[model samples]
Target: MKKDKEKVLDEVWTEDRVREFLASEPKAGTDADFHALLKAYQSMRADDFELFIGMFLETNRNLNATDKAGRTVLSYAKEHRNSGEHVAALEAKGAL
Candidate 1:
């Protein structure tokens, strides 16, 4: 039972799940979208974040999205600890 619970907790976020959440919004280039991406970046592992970002971009989501304070997802990834991989992924995607 404990192992089952742990497995559930360890369930990975799929591209479909990411799309479903983003699709809830009317548009893609909103501050809300940026914030959501920021939150996901902060919470997800480096590899998972890369996958999420890839899926996000695949759906035509904004890669250069910025928050109200004018912070881009690239900025957030750069500042995050152990996010070197994430930053590199974002850069490859042209996240400036």
Candidate 2:
């Protein structure tokens, strides 16, 4: 489970809050699209992440974007046993 120092259960996720993630940029050589997707996956719960994906797609972002290591967000989620919902969200979006 993700352990946050001050985790807020049942926290509200407004559209603006979720949309803010889209503005995230990566380091010089990192893929910007991939970075945004990865950040959202790491920061959001599966449901919110799914909502973020819809907004991401509306902006024409690449769902299959890979990191320098050639690992997509789905790859990272797959490595975690607790990521069933997250994996389902990625697959629903047709991520490779």
Candidate 3:
């Protein structure tokens, strides 16, 4: 089966655009910080995720925020098959 949408690998991400992910809000009862981190991880490349982490910490956001299920971004990243670099980035920032 052919997919209708094509994947974009080298999409340009500027600082402003990368910083925008910091404002991502979560659904009710979900952790805001976790949602932001997950969204940034899902959207940005590894380098951009690393850059976002810096800005996230500068704003005093929680790097260890957990979802309703108590799963941190690091926990989720560990489960993802392609998230090795993302996991490393999260760990370097001391995310639990």
Candidate 4:
């Protein structure tokens, strides 16, 4: 039970906010915008990284590949203490 609770904590997510933000995109723009969205989403839920990681990986070929916003995955994660898992997920997806 303790381990289960810890895993849930490591999961890190404020689901409602993250979902709403992701759903509110313009649908077409520079990869920078997409990166920003992913950055923001990951910041919210380090554990619930599926949405952002999947978004990037699914469109890997189309992704910006560079964070023009001058932010790195770890840098963004620094803003959200709960985002450790999210940072890991983004790294797995190849977000620089």
Q: Write the per-residue lDDT of candidate 2 for residues 1-96, one digit (tens) a residue.
A: 976688578888998999999999899999999999999999899899999999999999999999999989999999999999999999998999
lDDT of 3 by residue, 1-96 (tens): 999999887999999999999899789988889999989988888999999999999999999999888889899889989999999999999988
Off by over 4 Å in 4: 1-44, 61-69
Kindly list the per-residue Cα lDDT of model 4 for residues 1-96, writing each as its tens digit.
355444344444455655544454442543555555555664555445556556545544322343556555455665876666766766676566
**Candidate 4 global lDDT:** 0.54
- The TM-score of candidate 1 is 0.68
Off by over 4 Å in 3: 1-6
Q: Is candidate 1 or candidate 2 better by lDDT?
A: 2
Residue 2 displacement in candidate 1 (angstroms): 16
> Which one wins by lDDT: 2 or 3?
2
User: What RMSD does each model have against the real structure?
Assistant: 4.6, 4.1, 2.2, 8.6
Candidate lDDT values, in order:
0.72, 0.93, 0.92, 0.54
